[model samples]
Target: MKHYLLFAAGKDRPGIVAAISRILYRHGCNMADSTMTRIASEFAMLLIFQAPAGWRAERIGQELQRCEKRLGLFTGIKPLASSESRALKPKGRAHIISVYGADRPGIVYRVSRCLASKRINITHVSTHRTETSRAAGYVMLLEVELPSLRMAAGLNKSLGRLASGMGLHVSMRPVETAKL
Candidate 1:
Protein backbone atom coordinates (compact mmCIF):
# COMPACT_ATOMS: atom_id res chain seq x y z
CA MET A 1 0.00 0.00 0.00
CA LYS A 2 1.07 3.59 -0.65
CA HIS A 3 0.15 6.58 1.47
CA TYR A 4 -0.63 9.92 -0.16
CA LEU A 5 -1.72 13.39 0.81
CA LEU A 6 -4.19 14.92 -1.64
CA PHE A 7 -5.27 18.54 -1.83
CA ALA A 8 -8.19 19.79 -3.85
CA ALA A 9 -9.75 23.24 -4.11
CA GLY A 10 -12.33 24.96 -6.26
CA LYS A 11 -15.42 27.11 -6.24
CA ASP A 12 -17.98 25.79 -3.77
CA ARG A 13 -20.65 23.70 -5.44
CA PRO A 14 -22.66 20.56 -5.09
CA GLY A 15 -21.35 17.07 -5.96
CA ILE A 16 -17.68 17.99 -5.55
CA VAL A 17 -17.12 15.48 -2.76
CA ALA A 18 -18.87 12.75 -4.65
CA ALA A 19 -16.77 13.34 -7.73
CA ILE A 20 -13.52 13.22 -5.82
CA SER A 21 -14.55 10.20 -3.80
CA ARG A 22 -15.57 8.38 -6.95
CA ILE A 23 -12.05 8.69 -8.30
CA LEU A 24 -10.57 7.32 -5.12
CA TYR A 25 -13.06 4.54 -4.92
CA ARG A 26 -12.38 3.43 -8.48
CA HIS A 27 -8.66 3.33 -7.73
CA GLY A 28 -9.09 1.23 -4.60
CA CYS A 29 -7.99 4.05 -2.35
CA ASN A 30 -8.96 3.97 1.31
CA MET A 31 -9.35 7.35 2.90
CA ALA A 32 -7.65 7.48 6.28
CA ASP A 33 -8.53 11.06 7.14
CA SER A 34 -9.86 14.15 5.43
CA THR A 35 -11.06 17.70 6.02
CA MET A 36 -13.43 19.44 3.65
CA THR A 37 -14.66 22.97 4.13
CA ARG A 38 -15.90 26.01 2.27
CA ILE A 39 -14.23 29.31 2.95
CA ALA A 40 -15.82 32.32 1.27
CA SER A 41 -17.27 30.40 -1.64
CA GLU A 42 -14.18 28.26 -2.10
CA PHE A 43 -14.20 24.59 -1.27
CA ALA A 44 -10.91 23.21 0.04
CA MET A 45 -9.93 19.67 0.94
CA LEU A 46 -7.02 17.86 2.54
CA LEU A 47 -7.16 14.12 2.37
CA ILE A 48 -4.86 11.34 3.50
CA PHE A 49 -5.43 7.97 1.91
CA GLN A 50 -3.82 4.65 1.15
CA ALA A 51 -3.66 3.46 -2.43
CA PRO A 52 -3.37 -0.14 -3.36
CA ALA A 53 -0.03 -1.44 -4.59
CA GLY A 54 0.77 -0.87 -8.29
CA TRP A 55 -1.09 2.48 -8.37
CA ARG A 56 1.69 4.86 -9.29
CA ALA A 57 1.46 8.61 -8.94
CA GLU A 58 1.05 9.01 -12.68
CA ARG A 59 -1.75 6.49 -12.70
CA ILE A 60 -3.50 8.37 -9.95
CA GLY A 61 -3.11 11.61 -11.88
CA GLN A 62 -4.55 10.05 -14.98
CA GLU A 63 -7.52 8.79 -13.04
CA LEU A 64 -8.37 12.33 -11.92
CA GLN A 65 -7.48 14.06 -15.17
CA ARG A 66 -11.07 14.81 -16.04
CA CYS A 67 -12.44 15.08 -12.55
CA GLU A 68 -10.62 18.21 -11.46
CA LYS A 69 -11.01 20.13 -14.67
CA ARG A 70 -14.59 19.07 -15.07
CA LEU A 71 -15.35 20.17 -11.55
CA GLY A 72 -13.20 23.32 -11.84
CA LEU A 73 -10.94 22.17 -9.05
CA PHE A 74 -7.19 22.54 -8.66
CA THR A 75 -5.48 19.48 -7.24
CA GLY A 76 -2.13 18.30 -5.96
CA ILE A 77 -0.89 14.96 -4.75
CA LYS A 78 2.22 13.99 -2.80
CA PRO A 79 3.45 10.68 -1.46
CA LEU A 80 3.79 10.50 2.33
CA ALA A 81 6.05 8.27 4.39
CA SER A 82 4.39 6.22 7.13
CA SER A 83 7.15 5.66 9.68
CA GLU A 84 5.22 5.71 12.93
CA SER A 85 8.02 4.00 14.86
CA ARG A 86 10.31 6.94 14.21
CA ALA A 87 7.81 9.67 14.96
CA LEU A 88 7.63 11.44 18.32
CA LYS A 89 4.70 13.52 19.54
CA PRO A 90 5.52 17.05 20.60
CA LYS A 91 5.40 17.72 24.35
CA GLY A 92 2.47 20.04 24.92
CA ARG A 93 -1.14 20.43 25.97
CA ALA A 94 -3.73 21.51 23.42
CA HIS A 95 -5.32 24.96 23.74
CA ILE A 96 -7.92 26.75 21.67
CA ILE A 97 -7.59 30.46 20.98
CA SER A 98 -10.46 32.60 19.71
CA VAL A 99 -9.92 35.99 18.13
CA TYR A 100 -12.49 38.27 16.54
CA GLY A 101 -12.76 41.90 15.58
CA ALA A 102 -12.66 44.25 12.61
CA ASP A 103 -11.03 42.82 9.53
CA ARG A 104 -7.51 43.97 8.94
CA PRO A 105 -4.06 42.81 8.03
CA GLY A 106 -1.52 41.42 10.55
CA ILE A 107 -4.04 39.72 12.82
CA VAL A 108 -3.10 36.24 11.66
CA TYR A 109 0.57 37.06 11.28
CA ARG A 110 0.95 38.69 14.67
CA VAL A 111 -0.86 35.98 16.60
CA SER A 112 0.89 33.20 14.72
CA ARG A 113 4.26 34.83 15.18
CA CYS A 114 3.70 35.09 18.92
CA LEU A 115 3.11 31.35 19.13
CA ALA A 116 6.03 30.69 16.81
CA SER A 117 8.39 32.64 19.07
CA LYS A 118 7.59 30.19 21.85
CA ARG A 119 7.87 27.12 19.62
CA ILE A 120 4.16 26.46 20.05
CA ASN A 121 2.63 24.22 17.40
CA ILE A 122 -0.65 25.12 15.71
CA THR A 123 -2.60 21.97 14.92
CA HIS A 124 -5.51 23.61 13.13
CA VAL A 125 -7.21 26.95 12.47
CA SER A 126 -10.53 28.15 11.06
CA THR A 127 -11.41 31.71 10.18
CA HIS A 128 -14.36 33.60 8.75
CA ARG A 129 -14.91 37.15 7.58
CA THR A 130 -18.39 38.60 7.43
CA GLU A 131 -19.83 41.74 5.95
CA THR A 132 -23.40 41.32 7.13
CA SER A 133 -23.06 41.04 10.91
CA ARG A 134 -21.75 43.78 13.13
CA ALA A 135 -21.04 41.23 15.83
CA ALA A 136 -17.59 40.46 14.49
CA GLY A 137 -15.87 41.71 11.39
CA TYR A 138 -13.54 38.75 11.34
CA VAL A 139 -13.24 35.71 13.54
CA MET A 140 -10.48 33.13 13.93
CA LEU A 141 -10.38 29.92 15.94
CA LEU A 142 -6.95 28.38 16.40
CA GLU A 143 -5.92 25.15 18.08
CA VAL A 144 -2.43 25.32 19.48
CA GLU A 145 -0.27 23.12 21.68
CA LEU A 146 1.56 24.83 24.50
CA PRO A 147 4.74 23.61 26.11
CA SER A 148 3.05 23.52 29.52
CA LEU A 149 -0.36 24.19 31.01
CA ARG A 150 1.33 26.00 33.89
CA MET A 151 1.91 28.96 31.61
CA ALA A 152 -1.64 29.21 30.29
CA ALA A 153 -2.52 32.19 32.47
CA GLY A 154 0.59 34.21 31.60
CA LEU A 155 0.36 33.31 27.95
CA ASN A 156 -3.31 34.16 27.83
CA LYS A 157 -2.55 37.54 29.36
CA SER A 158 0.10 38.24 26.79
CA LEU A 159 -2.22 37.21 24.00
CA GLY A 160 -4.95 39.42 25.42
CA ARG A 161 -2.58 42.35 25.50
CA LEU A 162 -1.48 41.79 21.95
CA ALA A 163 -5.05 41.47 20.72
CA SER A 164 -6.23 44.53 22.62
CA GLY A 165 -3.58 46.65 20.94
CA MET A 166 -4.99 45.50 17.64
CA GLY A 167 -8.57 46.25 18.75
CA LEU A 168 -9.49 42.60 18.86
CA HIS A 169 -10.71 40.24 21.57
CA VAL A 170 -8.77 37.07 22.35
CA SER A 171 -9.18 34.13 24.72
CA MET A 172 -7.33 30.85 25.20
CA ARG A 173 -8.39 27.65 26.94
CA PRO A 174 -7.13 24.08 27.15
CA VAL A 175 -8.78 21.31 25.17
CA GLU A 176 -9.54 17.99 26.84
CA THR A 177 -8.91 14.86 24.83
CA ALA A 178 -9.89 11.24 25.44
CA LYS A 179 -7.74 8.25 24.53
CA LEU A 180 -10.62 6.05 23.51
Candidate 2:
Protein backbone atom coordinates (compact mmCIF):
# COMPACT_ATOMS: atom_id res chain seq x y z
CA MET A 1 0.00 0.00 0.00
CA LYS A 2 1.02 3.60 -0.55
CA HIS A 3 0.17 6.69 1.46
CA TYR A 4 -1.20 9.97 0.17
CA LEU A 5 -2.32 13.26 1.64
CA LEU A 6 -5.38 15.20 0.58
CA PHE A 7 -6.41 18.74 1.43
CA ALA A 8 -9.77 20.27 0.64
CA ALA A 9 -11.32 23.59 1.60
CA GLY A 10 -14.54 25.41 0.79
CA LYS A 11 -17.43 27.29 2.31
CA ASP A 12 -18.80 25.36 5.25
CA ARG A 13 -21.98 23.33 4.79
CA PRO A 14 -23.58 20.14 5.90
CA GLY A 15 -22.67 16.82 4.27
CA ILE A 16 -19.21 17.98 3.24
CA VAL A 17 -17.61 14.99 4.93
CA ALA A 18 -20.13 12.62 3.44
CA ALA A 19 -19.50 13.85 -0.07
CA ILE A 20 -15.73 13.69 0.23
CA SER A 21 -15.60 10.37 2.01
CA ARG A 22 -17.90 8.88 -0.58
CA ILE A 23 -15.42 9.70 -3.28
CA LEU A 24 -12.58 8.19 -1.33
CA TYR A 25 -14.59 5.05 -0.73
CA ARG A 26 -15.20 4.68 -4.43
CA HIS A 27 -11.50 5.13 -5.05
CA GLY A 28 -10.53 2.34 -2.61
CA CYS A 29 -8.68 4.64 -0.27
CA ASN A 30 -8.45 3.94 3.45
CA MET A 31 -8.37 7.03 5.59
CA ALA A 32 -5.58 6.57 8.12
CA ASP A 33 -5.73 9.98 9.76
CA SER A 34 -7.80 13.06 9.11
CA THR A 35 -8.65 16.47 10.50
CA MET A 36 -11.66 18.55 9.54
CA THR A 37 -12.80 21.88 10.93
CA ARG A 38 -14.43 25.15 10.12
CA ILE A 39 -12.27 28.23 10.17
CA ALA A 40 -14.52 31.21 9.89
CA SER A 41 -16.90 30.55 7.02
CA GLU A 42 -14.57 28.08 5.36
CA PHE A 43 -14.44 24.39 6.02
CA ALA A 44 -11.07 22.71 5.68
CA MET A 45 -10.01 19.08 5.78
CA LEU A 46 -6.74 17.21 5.59
CA LEU A 47 -6.71 13.47 5.18
CA ILE A 48 -3.84 11.03 5.15
CA PHE A 49 -4.92 7.80 3.54
CA GLN A 50 -3.50 4.53 2.28
CA ALA A 51 -4.47 2.66 -0.84
CA PRO A 52 -3.39 -0.46 -2.62
CA ALA A 53 -0.58 -0.50 -5.15
CA GLY A 54 -1.25 1.31 -8.41
CA TRP A 55 -3.50 3.82 -6.65
CA ARG A 56 -1.56 6.88 -7.67
CA ALA A 57 -2.14 10.45 -6.66
CA GLU A 58 -3.22 11.27 -10.17
CA ARG A 59 -6.03 8.76 -9.84
CA ILE A 60 -7.20 10.24 -6.58
CA GLY A 61 -6.99 13.71 -8.00
CA GLN A 62 -9.09 12.74 -10.95
CA GLU A 63 -11.59 11.05 -8.71
CA LEU A 64 -11.91 14.09 -6.41
CA GLN A 65 -12.01 16.68 -9.18
CA ARG A 66 -15.66 16.05 -9.80
CA CYS A 67 -16.46 16.10 -6.11
CA GLU A 68 -14.61 19.33 -5.74
CA LYS A 69 -16.55 20.93 -8.56
CA ARG A 70 -19.84 19.74 -7.15
CA LEU A 71 -18.98 20.73 -3.60
CA GLY A 72 -17.14 23.93 -4.48
CA LEU A 73 -13.99 22.84 -2.71
CA PHE A 74 -10.41 23.49 -3.76
CA THR A 75 -8.68 20.16 -3.49
CA GLY A 76 -5.16 18.84 -3.76
CA ILE A 77 -3.73 15.34 -3.52
CA LYS A 78 -0.14 14.27 -3.16
CA PRO A 79 1.80 11.13 -2.42
CA LEU A 80 3.53 10.90 0.96
CA ALA A 81 7.10 9.72 1.10
CA SER A 82 7.99 7.00 3.57
CA SER A 83 9.99 9.45 5.65
CA GLU A 84 7.01 11.76 6.00
CA SER A 85 4.82 8.88 7.14
CA ARG A 86 7.18 7.93 9.96
CA ALA A 87 6.76 10.60 12.65
CA LEU A 88 8.60 10.78 15.93
CA LYS A 89 6.81 9.44 19.01
CA PRO A 90 6.48 11.65 22.10
CA LYS A 91 8.91 10.60 24.80
CA GLY A 92 7.08 12.38 27.64
CA ARG A 93 3.86 14.14 28.56
CA ALA A 94 1.26 15.84 26.39
CA HIS A 95 0.20 19.42 27.08
CA ILE A 96 -2.21 21.86 25.59
CA ILE A 97 -0.89 25.36 25.05
CA SER A 98 -3.15 28.33 24.61
CA VAL A 99 -1.92 31.63 23.22
CA TYR A 100 -4.03 34.69 22.78
CA GLY A 101 -3.88 38.49 22.81
CA ALA A 102 -3.95 41.43 20.44
CA ASP A 103 -3.62 40.11 16.93
CA ARG A 104 -0.45 40.66 14.98
CA PRO A 105 1.68 39.01 12.36
CA GLY A 106 4.21 36.25 13.07
CA ILE A 107 2.49 34.92 16.18
CA VAL A 108 2.21 31.44 14.78
CA TYR A 109 5.62 31.54 13.17
CA ARG A 110 7.38 32.80 16.26
CA VAL A 111 5.66 30.49 18.74
CA SER A 112 5.91 27.40 16.58
CA ARG A 113 9.51 28.13 15.73
CA CYS A 114 10.34 28.34 19.41
CA LEU A 115 8.69 25.00 20.06
CA ALA A 116 10.48 23.46 17.09
CA SER A 117 13.82 24.63 18.42
CA LYS A 118 13.10 22.73 21.63
CA ARG A 119 12.22 19.60 19.61
CA ILE A 120 8.73 19.71 21.09
CA ASN A 121 6.38 18.03 18.67
CA ILE A 122 3.12 19.88 18.07
CA THR A 123 0.40 17.36 17.44
CA HIS A 124 -2.37 19.80 16.61
CA VAL A 125 -2.99 23.53 16.38
CA SER A 126 -6.07 25.68 15.88
CA THR A 127 -6.06 29.45 15.66
CA HIS A 128 -8.68 32.12 15.19
CA ARG A 129 -8.99 35.82 14.70
CA THR A 130 -11.38 37.20 17.27
CA GLU A 131 -11.29 40.99 17.02
CA THR A 132 -11.42 43.18 13.94
CA SER A 133 -10.08 46.52 15.06
CA ARG A 134 -6.91 48.43 15.74
CA ALA A 135 -6.38 46.01 18.61
CA ALA A 136 -7.70 42.92 17.00
CA GLY A 137 -7.19 39.80 19.08
CA TYR A 138 -6.19 36.30 18.04
CA VAL A 139 -6.37 32.97 19.81
CA MET A 140 -4.43 29.75 19.28
CA LEU A 141 -4.61 26.36 20.92
CA LEU A 142 -1.80 23.89 20.42
CA GLU A 143 -1.35 20.32 21.55
CA VAL A 144 2.31 19.74 22.25
CA GLU A 145 4.42 17.04 23.83
CA LEU A 146 7.26 17.70 26.27
CA PRO A 147 9.90 14.99 26.04
CA SER A 148 10.81 15.22 29.72
CA LEU A 149 9.45 16.69 32.94
CA ARG A 150 12.58 18.82 33.15
CA MET A 151 11.90 20.08 29.65
CA ALA A 152 8.40 21.10 30.69
CA ALA A 153 9.64 23.65 33.24
CA GLY A 154 12.07 25.25 30.83
CA LEU A 155 9.49 25.22 28.06
CA ASN A 156 6.90 26.93 30.25
CA LYS A 157 9.35 29.65 31.22
CA SER A 158 10.53 30.16 27.67
CA LEU A 159 7.01 30.32 26.35
CA GLY A 160 6.12 32.84 29.05
CA ARG A 161 9.03 35.06 28.17
CA LEU A 162 8.24 34.83 24.47
CA ALA A 163 4.58 35.58 25.08
CA SER A 164 5.38 38.51 27.35
CA GLY A 165 7.67 39.97 24.74
CA MET A 166 4.88 39.72 22.18
CA GLY A 167 2.22 41.01 24.60
CA LEU A 168 0.33 37.74 24.45
CA HIS A 169 -1.03 35.46 27.17
CA VAL A 170 0.12 31.84 27.01
CA SER A 171 -0.80 28.89 29.19
CA MET A 172 0.14 25.23 29.22
CA ARG A 173 -2.02 22.49 30.73
CA PRO A 174 -0.72 18.94 30.98
CA VAL A 175 -3.03 16.25 29.59
CA GLU A 176 -3.44 12.75 30.93
CA THR A 177 -3.18 10.12 28.26
CA ALA A 178 -5.78 7.44 28.42
CA LYS A 179 -4.86 3.76 28.37
CA LEU A 180 -7.79 1.93 26.92
Candidate 3:
Protein backbone atom coordinates (compact mmCIF):
# COMPACT_ATOMS: atom_id res chain seq x y z
CA MET A 1 0.00 0.00 0.00
CA LYS A 2 1.12 3.57 -0.79
CA HIS A 3 0.36 6.67 1.21
CA TYR A 4 -1.34 9.75 -0.14
CA LEU A 5 -2.42 13.03 1.39
CA LEU A 6 -5.74 14.65 0.63
CA PHE A 7 -6.64 18.28 1.18
CA ALA A 8 -10.28 19.24 1.15
CA ALA A 9 -12.02 22.50 1.90
CA GLY A 10 -15.43 23.99 1.42
CA LYS A 11 -18.15 26.08 2.97
CA ASP A 12 -19.26 24.81 6.36
CA ARG A 13 -22.12 22.35 6.18
CA PRO A 14 -23.18 18.95 7.43
CA GLY A 15 -22.37 15.65 5.67
CA ILE A 16 -19.03 16.74 4.24
CA VAL A 17 -17.22 13.97 6.05
CA ALA A 18 -19.78 11.42 4.97
CA ALA A 19 -19.35 12.45 1.36
CA ILE A 20 -15.56 12.23 1.50
CA SER A 21 -15.51 9.01 3.43
CA ARG A 22 -17.91 7.42 0.98
CA ILE A 23 -15.55 8.25 -1.85
CA LEU A 24 -12.62 6.77 0.03
CA TYR A 25 -14.60 3.66 0.75
CA ARG A 26 -15.39 3.21 -2.91
CA HIS A 27 -11.73 3.58 -3.79
CA GLY A 28 -10.40 0.97 -1.36
CA CYS A 29 -8.50 3.62 0.60
CA ASN A 30 -7.74 3.30 4.28
CA MET A 31 -7.63 6.48 6.26
CA ALA A 32 -4.58 6.50 8.51
CA ASP A 33 -4.76 9.95 10.04
CA SER A 34 -6.88 13.01 9.55
CA THR A 35 -7.61 16.42 10.99
CA MET A 36 -10.67 18.53 10.27
CA THR A 37 -11.62 21.92 11.60
CA ARG A 38 -13.38 25.12 10.83
CA ILE A 39 -11.12 28.14 10.58
CA ALA A 40 -13.45 31.11 10.32
CA SER A 41 -16.29 30.25 7.92
CA GLU A 42 -14.58 27.61 5.85
CA PHE A 43 -14.38 23.93 6.66
CA ALA A 44 -11.01 22.39 6.01
CA MET A 45 -9.63 18.86 6.23
CA LEU A 46 -6.22 17.23 5.85
CA LEU A 47 -6.22 13.48 5.52
CA ILE A 48 -3.61 10.78 5.05
CA PHE A 49 -4.71 7.52 3.55
CA GLN A 50 -3.10 4.33 2.36
CA ALA A 51 -4.16 3.30 -1.12
CA PRO A 52 -3.92 -0.15 -2.49
CA ALA A 53 -1.44 -0.77 -5.27
CA GLY A 54 -2.21 0.70 -8.71
CA TRP A 55 -4.34 3.47 -7.23
CA ARG A 56 -3.01 6.65 -8.80
CA ALA A 57 -3.26 10.10 -7.27
CA GLU A 58 -4.75 11.43 -10.49
CA ARG A 59 -7.64 8.98 -10.28
CA ILE A 60 -8.29 10.05 -6.72
CA GLY A 61 -8.24 13.64 -7.87
CA GLN A 62 -10.85 12.88 -10.48
CA GLU A 63 -13.10 11.15 -7.98
CA LEU A 64 -12.71 14.02 -5.56
CA GLN A 65 -13.60 16.47 -8.30
CA ARG A 66 -16.84 14.63 -8.83
CA CYS A 67 -17.44 14.78 -5.12
CA GLU A 68 -16.71 18.49 -5.09
CA LYS A 69 -19.16 19.09 -7.86
CA ARG A 70 -21.86 17.10 -6.12
CA LEU A 71 -21.18 18.56 -2.69
CA GLY A 72 -20.16 22.07 -3.75
CA LEU A 73 -16.74 21.65 -2.16
CA PHE A 74 -13.12 21.98 -3.32
CA THR A 75 -10.75 19.06 -3.07
CA GLY A 76 -7.16 18.34 -3.90
CA ILE A 77 -5.22 15.10 -3.69
CA LYS A 78 -1.54 14.37 -3.89
CA PRO A 79 0.83 11.49 -3.29
CA LEU A 80 2.80 11.87 -0.09
CA ALA A 81 6.50 12.04 -0.69
CA SER A 82 8.61 9.34 0.98
CA SER A 83 10.47 11.94 3.03
CA GLU A 84 7.31 13.77 4.02
CA SER A 85 5.57 10.63 5.25
CA ARG A 86 7.93 10.33 8.20
CA ALA A 87 6.76 12.54 11.06
CA LEU A 88 9.10 14.72 13.06
CA LYS A 89 10.53 13.15 16.21
CA PRO A 90 11.23 15.63 18.98
CA LYS A 91 14.63 15.33 20.65
CA GLY A 92 14.55 17.28 23.90
CA ARG A 93 11.83 18.80 26.09
CA ALA A 94 8.36 19.76 25.00
CA HIS A 95 6.96 22.95 26.48
CA ILE A 96 3.82 24.98 26.26
CA ILE A 97 4.15 28.76 25.87
CA SER A 98 1.15 30.81 26.84
CA VAL A 99 0.73 34.52 26.20
CA TYR A 100 -2.17 36.75 27.13
CA GLY A 101 -2.58 40.49 26.87
CA ALA A 102 -4.65 43.28 25.40
CA ASP A 103 -5.70 42.51 21.88
CA ARG A 104 -3.27 44.20 19.55
CA PRO A 105 -1.16 43.66 16.49
CA GLY A 106 2.34 42.14 16.59
CA ILE A 107 1.81 39.95 19.67
CA VAL A 108 2.39 36.81 17.65
CA TYR A 109 5.09 38.52 15.65
CA ARG A 110 7.15 39.71 18.61
CA VAL A 111 6.87 36.45 20.52
CA SER A 112 7.48 34.17 17.57
CA ARG A 113 10.38 36.33 16.48
CA CYS A 114 12.07 35.78 19.83
CA LEU A 115 11.54 32.02 19.61
CA ALA A 116 12.79 31.95 16.04
CA SER A 117 16.00 33.72 17.04
CA LYS A 118 16.65 30.94 19.52
CA ARG A 119 16.06 28.22 16.87
CA ILE A 120 13.07 26.83 18.72
CA ASN A 121 10.51 24.86 16.74
CA ILE A 122 6.83 25.53 17.21
CA THR A 123 4.89 22.28 16.83
CA HIS A 124 1.41 23.68 17.26
CA VAL A 125 -0.05 27.14 17.78
CA SER A 126 -3.55 28.35 18.55
CA THR A 127 -4.36 32.04 18.94
CA HIS A 128 -7.64 33.79 19.52
CA ARG A 129 -9.29 36.86 20.97
CA THR A 130 -11.76 36.33 23.75
CA GLU A 131 -13.91 38.42 26.07
CA THR A 132 -12.70 37.36 29.48
CA SER A 133 -11.37 39.58 32.22
CA ARG A 134 -10.15 42.42 29.99
CA ALA A 135 -12.60 43.93 27.51
CA ALA A 136 -10.34 42.93 24.64
CA GLY A 137 -7.97 40.07 25.35
CA TYR A 138 -5.64 38.04 23.14
CA VAL A 139 -4.40 34.57 24.01
CA MET A 140 -1.71 32.55 22.31
CA LEU A 141 -0.92 28.93 23.10
CA LEU A 142 2.09 27.32 21.50
CA GLU A 143 3.52 23.81 21.78
CA VAL A 144 7.25 24.16 21.34
CA GLU A 145 10.07 21.67 20.82
CA LEU A 146 13.07 22.81 22.81
CA PRO A 147 16.60 21.87 21.87
CA SER A 148 18.23 19.23 24.10
CA LEU A 149 21.24 21.38 24.86
CA ARG A 150 19.32 24.61 25.68
CA MET A 151 18.51 25.43 29.26
CA ALA A 152 14.90 26.21 30.11
CA ALA A 153 16.02 28.90 32.54
CA GLY A 154 17.76 30.91 29.84
CA LEU A 155 14.79 30.58 27.48
CA ASN A 156 12.38 31.68 30.19
CA LYS A 157 14.52 34.71 30.97
CA SER A 158 14.52 35.79 27.34
CA LEU A 159 10.79 35.29 27.07
CA GLY A 160 10.23 37.27 30.25
CA ARG A 161 12.09 40.25 28.86
CA LEU A 162 10.13 40.08 25.64
CA ALA A 163 6.84 39.85 27.51
CA SER A 164 7.71 42.79 29.75
CA GLY A 165 8.51 44.96 26.75
CA MET A 166 5.25 43.95 25.06
CA GLY A 167 3.07 44.34 28.15
CA LEU A 168 1.97 40.72 27.94
CA HIS A 169 1.98 37.86 30.41
CA VAL A 170 4.10 34.93 29.29
CA SER A 171 4.59 31.55 30.89
CA MET A 172 6.44 28.43 29.77
CA ARG A 173 6.19 25.02 31.39
CA PRO A 174 7.03 21.48 30.50
CA VAL A 175 4.06 19.85 28.77
CA GLU A 176 2.79 16.69 30.42
CA THR A 177 2.80 13.84 27.95
CA ALA A 178 0.83 11.11 29.66
CA LYS A 179 -2.92 11.11 29.84
CA LEU A 180 -4.71 10.10 33.00
Candidate 3, residues 55-153, lDDT tens digits: the string is 777766777788898778988877887667667688668999999988888999988998889888998899988886648889999988888636678
- Ordered from best to worst lDDT, the candidate numbers read 2, 3, 1
Better of 1 and 2 by TM-score: 1
Q: Please state every model's RMSD to the true fold in angstroms.
A: 2.6, 2.6, 2.5
Which ranges in model 2 have alpha carbons more than 4 Å from their true place?
81-88, 132-135, 178-180
State every prediction's TM-score relative to the real structure: 0.88, 0.83, 0.86
| TM-score, prediction 2 | 0.83
Q: Write the per-residue lDDT of candidate 1 for residues 94-152, one digit (tens) a residue.
A: 89999999988888999998888778889889888878645548888999888888778
The Cα RMSD in angstroms, rounded to one decimal, for candidate 2 relative to the true structure is 2.6
Alpha-carbon error at 110 in model 2, in Å?
2.1
Candidate numbers, best TM-score first, in rank order = 1, 3, 2
**74-180, model 2: which lDDT tens digit per residue?**
98888888667665666668899999999989999999999999999888898988765566899999998788888888999999999999999999999976799
The regions of model 1 sitting more than 4 angstroms off are 84-90, 132-136, 177-180
